[model samples]
Target: MVAFHASALDGVARNPALPTPLLLRLLAFDGGGDGPPRYAPQRAGLPESAVAVILAHPNPGARVDFAMSKLAEPAQRARLVDDPSPKVRAALAYGPEWGDPRASVALPDDVCARLLDDPDPSVRTALLDSPHLAPSFVASLATHHDPAARQVAARAWEKLAPDERLALLTDPDPEVRRVAALGQCRRDAHLTAELLRDPQFAAEALRRGLLHRADAERHVAERTHLAALAENPSLPADLVERLAVDPDEGVRLAVSLRPELDETRRMAIDFTVGDLDRGDGVHWVREGLADPEVLRRAATSAHPLLRRSAARSPHLPPDLLHLLARVEDPVVENRLGIHHPDTPEEVLMRVYARLGGTFSAWMAETHPRFPREGLAARYADHPDGNYRRLAVRDPAATPTLIERLSHDPTVWTRQAAVGDPRLPLHRLREALHVPELASSAGANPALPEDEMAAVLNRAGVPA
Candidate 1:
């Protein structure tokens, strides 16, 4: 509801470019209700004056919002550490939750260090969740009075020294000891060998550590063991070969998808693939990329799967793109058309026309390369109403056509039309009454500043 927050005023409070004087008043402004401040403290370009107002505001709500905001300069962190409310301090201590406005910002390390010694247990507990803690601090968490904190440190057991890891193995807490055992088994071959003798620990060891060929071979008769072996990225080439022809179809399918194999070898394996989805689904999602030769060979490979894999490489050189373009696969075109920097203008349009409603098509429709010249005139009366909506993107689109499209039978076409700055002011105002277009109208850039302030005034905000 627009009435939910006093300053909610359409989206003005969310604007990063609002002048500092107005922003200060909004930060401290309380309009008789207890709703949290809608004015986002994390919005960029906040001046020091705005920060000072947020810190001194009588309402703790705005202060808490600023506490979790990523904007605090390193020098300003100490003041935040001393915030009057524990709730605010806890917000500062813990990183923002996923949907919080502040989640994307980095809280300074100095602030985190100060919060490490916070008197409140809640504040201390929140600190443990923050990834920004210093390495030494995480290592010392092993001895924290709280067992929960110690258990968290066990997850980072590799950071501990050899003697420290040994100490954790014998810790009084059984849960801590169990988590630590995985680390120890992976680190010490002798301990791993001992643990393998027990069936329970052996299964965990297979999942967590690289296995010698003899140990790996010992487990292959069971379908469950073969599945684990094929799923393990650490499985050596010889182990992959041994699992390749195992009687279980699931095991072979798992091997076929492993990062180590190319298209030809994968097709030769014993499994039948169901749906062939994006080739980059598994390994290419990581920071490290497939080798240049792998990508090049895949780009030129006869397998549609390999070509799709090559298209997923954002760093594909021009030569590979040229090769893949000739292949003309829809999946390959989807990946390259929207994501690759060097995709041709013709490809962008073709992808937009062919792959409608798909993620790539949406991206391609808005892409700078899609020709904008006289687009409104060309697509204005297109039989497909969806295509007529493309006119809104053309700079040549007249206010008259924008007005006509604002009443389009296709609802999205109308919503997109009203959002277009070229839509006449009268039509944009009318859109505010249509539920579907209300949000789009309120956020429309064409809504003049004074008109926005008037809307806020009517909504109960003081001038």
Candidate 2:
């Protein structure tokens, strides 16, 4: 009899109750009978029989694992290596005996096969991490109809032969296909080149290849593949278009920003921005939105993302805001800052109001080339109070308009009037006295104190 204690598990075993000799004999063997054993062993000094009873006891899982881990002998430990209970097997797997093939017990082939099929994924994960798992066994797992097993096989693929690795390239599962793609990228260069040339596989392969290779040969191959893929008319147009719109800003910038594009092709793709399939919608929205011809085409495109992209075109001339104003989509309409007669006065007013600060701030932060003064002046006299308010904030805002809006009943209108940079200091002082206009003075930091003061005076406040 002995008391067991270790630093690793802290003091969990310090006071464990020791099983009686009779109970220990029952646990150490499969054959058993009958009921409660009498007289448990004394709690402090545990006998070897007590340890055997603890390892084999059919009670809670935690207790079984704790006891098996405490066992130190080979024959006793081998007794559990293939225990029918996965919990018992797992406990053995986690034990120090796991690394010693000499201690390995022969697992039933059927049991190993069933474990390979376990619906629980972690069981298989444990299998792969085991030392020198047989390649034949792993090969069977790789082709397993179960997507999870195939994925596991795909990961530890260096052990697989080229053909065996290539077999998974068309796996039914997307994740499997992705993993197979990674494996394919490394082992078989010929297959990788084939994938890079196949339009269907080129995009996915290129995306994965970039992660694997970086030297000059790989770079040249990648460029040559992209340029060749770009010209393949038989390739799906949408995929090609995606290439044209590659999320890599560098790629998008390259196509649209290229100075070498012939005027004819550039203009042709520009005009096609609205052509349902040929519409260089992405590049058009990227570069052509400034041209009226381009905006009209983009405004009519059926694609929503393209339409949204078109709306963001900042290069549109001032006079074109009227045409863009007619776009039915609010997303595009808002981006164009249209103030047309058909546009609801409310929306027009919001657009105008946004121009001075909210609009300008967003533009400067996200899209730097937004032309501010010219656009604001175009709508200075808009009938909507919101538009009038925005006009007042523009650097181009006039004194006469400031004086008129200072008296306007709408608080927002009065605020805009008081914030006008064009208003004389006396007029701004006057406007500041009006209670409704007072708070409007400091609302926009962009509205200089001198301009706000001029608006305050115009509203009849003393400055």
Candidate 3:
């Protein structure tokens, strides 16, 4: 049999008139050592019986290869749509040829219907891309149980009937409704009003002009709706002003931070210390508070939480920051350490002198103008490992100081020394045998390429 198949291959290669089934059988055989058969027939030229034989091949690879080939008849491709193999169906569904409307023109309605109910979501999704799919069938898949299918249907939203689009507005899937709301609800005021009741769709509706002033007035009464409404940039100034004091601190805080608020409106908006208790509200208010006076008041408020909130404000005056620095509160101290750029130099020096024992390491590593020289000199022999590490990383660190730090008992200090640009290659070479320092030493640009290559090669690593 093997000899016969081998001879058939040579004959088919020599003559084009050989039967395609014989050519396909030879191609499907796994010629272990004799090398693969050479007869390759184009799908369009293959007989229907030959195409069927390829599709029926037990190996999915053979079926996929054939499905991916060009077929002369849509019916031939349609026959495999219900082949009980999801992968086979998927290949036909997503094939580029099906993207052209003419390729699906001869496909029977029963075949298109079976593809719509295909168990694989990907097959259903790819079916939606077929230009010849009926509008009614596309609409049916719009609410298909699979969110992925509905997501595809949402892209064809404009082609769906008005009622079909409305049905999807409340589809169980949030993503499906979100897509539908953005595409279909913009022009229908009634549908827009209905979607506004759902917080997920409210903001999009308002931004698209689907929600009018009356809709905003009616929906603003609901707190859930207020969050989305607060983000709408086009809300009337008067309505925004009304919402600025909507009794819900969330609403007030949202309104206060809107960039659309003019100077007078922003200044007029009020937030009590209680508003700072809501973590999210305070975060947004702190980020948006531009009024120096409000920030100053919050900075000096008797309530520590309120003061902490104010201290976090990026817009706080440098003078207020200096004042807040002296409060001795950990929260206030940490905030000051991070926002120290605008603080007065004298205040920074004073804070460094007073709390240098506690925050010196962090300040040295992070502060732009941190007294690197002062800290290095002051903490050169500090007992704290972090302080020692910071000293090694400081710009004032001498090569000798780094060399001494390289021999520190702590691995962290050794790791820090490995990263220091001033560490001599000789010192790095000494540390290479230490497994912990290998990665850092290997990455150092100062290490000679040839030396690093030799070190990595000795460690059984590719250079």
Runs in model 2 deviating more than 4 A are 1-56, 62-110, 119-136, 161-163, 187-463
For candidate 3, lDDT tens digit of each residue in 1-463? 3332333233232233444433454445444433223233223566766666656766555555455454436666667786767877876665434322113333455676687688787777667665555555565677566786687677677678777787787788888877787776657667677766666666667644355778777766555557557655557778787888788876666666564455566657675544243442343336545678667656665545546667655567767877787776655655555554554444455555455455433452356655455556866687866567768746788889888888877777777787566888788766655566654554454655454435423422221
Best by TM-score: 1
Q: Clashing residue pairs, candidate 3?
A: none
* Candidate 1 wrong stretches, greater than 4 Å: 1-8, 15-26, 29-42, 54-105, 112-204, 233-239, 259-263, 272-287, 290-379, 382-390, 429-435
Q: How close is every model to the real structure, measured as TM-score? A: 0.68, 0.29, 0.41
Please report the TM-score between candidate 1 and the true structure. Answer: 0.68
Question: Model 2 misses residue 367 by how many Å?
Answer: 66
- Model 1 accuracy (lDDT, Cα): 0.67
Candidate 1 lDDT over 206-230, as tens digits, reads 6556566566667774444676568
Residue 40, model 3: lDDT of: 33
In terms of TM-score, how similar is model 2 to the real structure? 0.29
lDDT of residue 282 for candidate 2: 53
Candidate 3: regions farther than 4 A off? 1-200, 206-210, 222-224, 236-238, 272-375, 382-384, 393-396, 424-426, 446-450
Of 1 and 3, which scores higher on lDDT? 1
